[model samples]
Target: MPGFAAHSWSACGYSVQKVYEWLLGSQQRVTWQPFVWNRLSLPKHNFLAWLFGKKRCLTQDRLIKFGVITDGIYYLCGAQQETQAHLFFDCCYSQRCAHLLQHWLGVYWQGDCVYWVIKWRCKSLCKKMIVMAAISGLLYCIWEARNKCKANMVMKRPEAVIEHVQAAIRWRLQRSDFVQQKDSTIAWIRDKRLS
Candidate 1:
């Protein structure tokens, strides 16, 4: 299982050796410890610039079309100005979702968007994949939820969104081999720490 995890991580541009250390939870823990625990634990170097090999959405480009600058407002959040940073990281609604994730992970919530995604460290390959999927799923769901809330389809609650993310993670993990081995690994990790 660890072997397969290594292969997956390497394929994703991560260092297999570093991943081994991370899986053992022996890596230097990042002090930022935002809303999600261990989601952003990897050093800056390990971060993939593109999410799942897809281009990142640039907010500055969107602003030109929205013409919010001429109108004295931001389109995404209806703020006085629109920028990529504001659209992804600084938006009020997104901040709430980020906060919810931080609380769920039992960690502090920092405001670094790119760093938030880059620092994740998972001991096992399967768990690492699951965590990545959960992060993406959470971000997607929040975006959709925010749009729905803005349109009056429903109200947005960060907790509820987080619940959706957890459900999504469970659904994905059930089909994979990771969950089958979690009980043993948990015990092993615990024992390793004690020794």
Candidate 2:
């Protein structure tokens, strides 16, 4: 067995491969960062919160220690359980965001997870990457907006967040090489009259 010092990194969820990457001076992105220090199943939830500066600036833990459940019954909208999945994907507010995304993509997303639809249905790698970025941005914005609501800040409406998510996705798509071409092709196909 290895010495205590050598084994300590793994205690914090650092794999040998991740440590090697860090030692090799890899540029840090959210996807490449170390796992969080909590035992929470939704590690991605922490990542999304951190990425968008949610629960970062404030001393929320102090408030939490005073016996407060910040997300009691979901402050976003009166939904079921206030879980990360519900807030991010299944909530009424989140479903509105998802509907905006669906309309923007011109496709129906049947699955629950964002990555599944992007990987399985996105026709091209570029579109898939764009969708992944869109998902990230939407999740980040939702967290930020949720935090604002928690702190009683001037927050935009949930519908506005859905519009923002759609706009961001469209902006990314516009920067892609094939978005215009794909749009033109679809329009042409749709507009053609039957003989």
Candidate 3:
């Protein structure tokens, strides 16, 4: 063990790696960043991210498998099973949302899966935050819209869904002052300023 030093980077005098080892144990690895739990972060979006990363969100396929839903078909397109892959990536509704996001953020991305798209989308930290905010908001909006469609029999257009995402991310940015954005990026997302 390292001897305690008053100015040690870690309070217990262990290095950052040791802290990670202690927290995650020997087998599991944490995929999301530590900054994800910042005070101003959106709890709903964060929760959705947790479900999404775990592939535990109740997609139609999972519901059917659990005998909660009769059919595994996607409501949006009716052409494929509403598994996590279909709902978040392959279905037309999701693809339309992706296109709208790409246009709004002035970026081009291509991947058959959500994880791949998110992983290789951008290199800049500031841009990464913007993109993550967009993706997170979009996921929340899509899932809500899906539920509403089932309950209220109303399926929103891709444009309407994108508007919902815009509102959500804008509101979230206003609430969080931690992640500052560049002027150009702010202009791109159309947010007046970083809160």
Candidate 4:
């Protein structure tokens, strides 16, 4: 703070605004922010972080530990003790959803860890952002599905959740300015279509 220099402007001469923009433009932010913030809509993005972090008492295991509901193993499949990882990654319903989702996006997501997958580097920023959105959407929709299961409502199937994931990514891409400016962005889409 003592070395602060408002007198010295960025080389582009855009002042502090340029510095802030440059800071945010780094590849590291591209890897992480879309998962925690930016890209996706507000509150949905916020909620995704909370859900993926397993901070809420939504999972069956968490509820059981908290002594809430004692019976259900998992809301979606009712197969295994519901930890966040099991419910979202290992559940049959969710795994089917992920498979269909990968087909829809024309990408196979590697890695068992969500954070690892989210941080997986891509040459195309567009693809990176899309992957981030998919991860977030999958978690959100799964959590929402779990909630519906608890409420005795009609539960969405894996296909339906894949549709939700596609819709969310499509909507985000349609509005993303970065996608328009980045050449690498279009290559993933092009390759996806060709494949």
Each prediction's TM-score versus the true structure? 0.51, 0.53, 0.75, 0.69
Better of 2 and 3 by TM-score: 3
Candidate 3 lDDT for residue 105: 70
* All candidates: CA RMSD (Å): 13.1, 10.0, 6.4, 7.3
lDDT per residue, candidate 2, 1-195, as tens digits? 354356577577767786676566766454312222122113354376454333242324334555764544556775564556666777778777766766655556665645453245545545454455555666766777777876795656766775665555554454555445555533432343212
Candidate 1 residue lDDT tens string, 1-195: 786575686577777676687668755664333323333222221232233123344334464666743443444456646454564557786677767665554345366643554475646644444445555666566555655764575766667777776665554444544356455533332232100
TM-score of structure candidate 3: 0.75
In model 3, where do residues sit more than 4 Å from their true spots? Answer: 1-25, 30-41, 112-118, 121-123, 180-182, 191-195
- Ranking by TM-score, best first? 3, 4, 2, 1
Question: Any idea what lDDT model 4 has?
Answer: 0.67
The CA lDDT of each predicted structure is 0.51, 0.54, 0.70, 0.67
Residues forming the 10-long window of minimal summed lDDT in candidate 3: 32-41
Error of 2 at 114 (Å): 2.0
Predicted structure 2: clash tally: 0
Sorted on lDDT, best first, the list reads: 3, 4, 2, 1
Model 2 scores a C-alpha lDDT of 0.54
lDDT per residue for candidate 4 within 1-195, as digits (tens), equals 322354345333556666676566654333444466646433585576655664564677777888988875776787778887787778888888777767866668755645765667767656766676676787778888888887886789877787776666666766667677356565454345211
TM-score of 2: 0.53
